[model samples]
Target: MFAARRFVLAARSAASIGSKRAVHKGIEGTPPMRYMSVAERIAVYGLITVSFLSYPTYLMINLDNIRPKGENSLGDNALAEKERRAAVRA
Candidate 1:
């Protein structure tokens, strides 16, 4: 009971304080809701693409450690096979 009341009070205080700050002048006295430039959008998309592309690279690196020596691929490898089984649902 006490914890719930305290949480409510804190949330109210935070909302009120945030609204007060929202009125303050942002960078160059401009609000942040403004749209980004075309160049900025392109850079942001490029960053996102790079970030996603690296994900497969990291997974490949970990899986590439033992491709020879008659060992199985990452899915069939003993270690990763256990993990794969755990992740898969019947």
Candidate 2:
């Protein structure tokens, strides 16, 4: 009985899948960017530029915070310290 019910459900799902249709046919061809006003275009381009540049700008601004702990910009003092500790241990 369960197997028959499962078969009925599966058949209904297959029929529903085949009956599916595209509800909205979206705009074809070129995007709507050409229709934008000059100010709108400038604002859109400015936002895009800012978004693209934000990460690099943030990295530059907070370089010390972003770097891994114990790492120095001048050199790898962490490695030297590890070596010194190892020598002391030995």
lDDT of 1 by residue, 18-74 (tens): 998888757766743357888888888899999999989887888857465575455
Q: List the global CA lDDT of all models.
A: 0.81, 0.83
lDDT of 2 by residue, 1-90 (tens): 999999999999988876663333346544789679999999999999999999999989999888778834545797789888999999
Worst 10 residues of 1 by lDDT: 67-76
- Number of residue pairs clashing in candidate 1, backbone atoms closer than 3 angstroms, sequence gap of 3 or more or interchain: 0
Number of the top candidate by TM-score?
Answer: 2
What RMSD, rounded to one decimal, does every model reach? Answer: 16.6, 12.1
Q: Each candidate's TM vs. the true structure? A: 0.34, 0.43
Q: Candidate 1: where are CA atoms >4 Å away? A: 1-25, 28-35, 66-90
* Shift of residue 21 alpha carbon in model 1, Å: 4.8
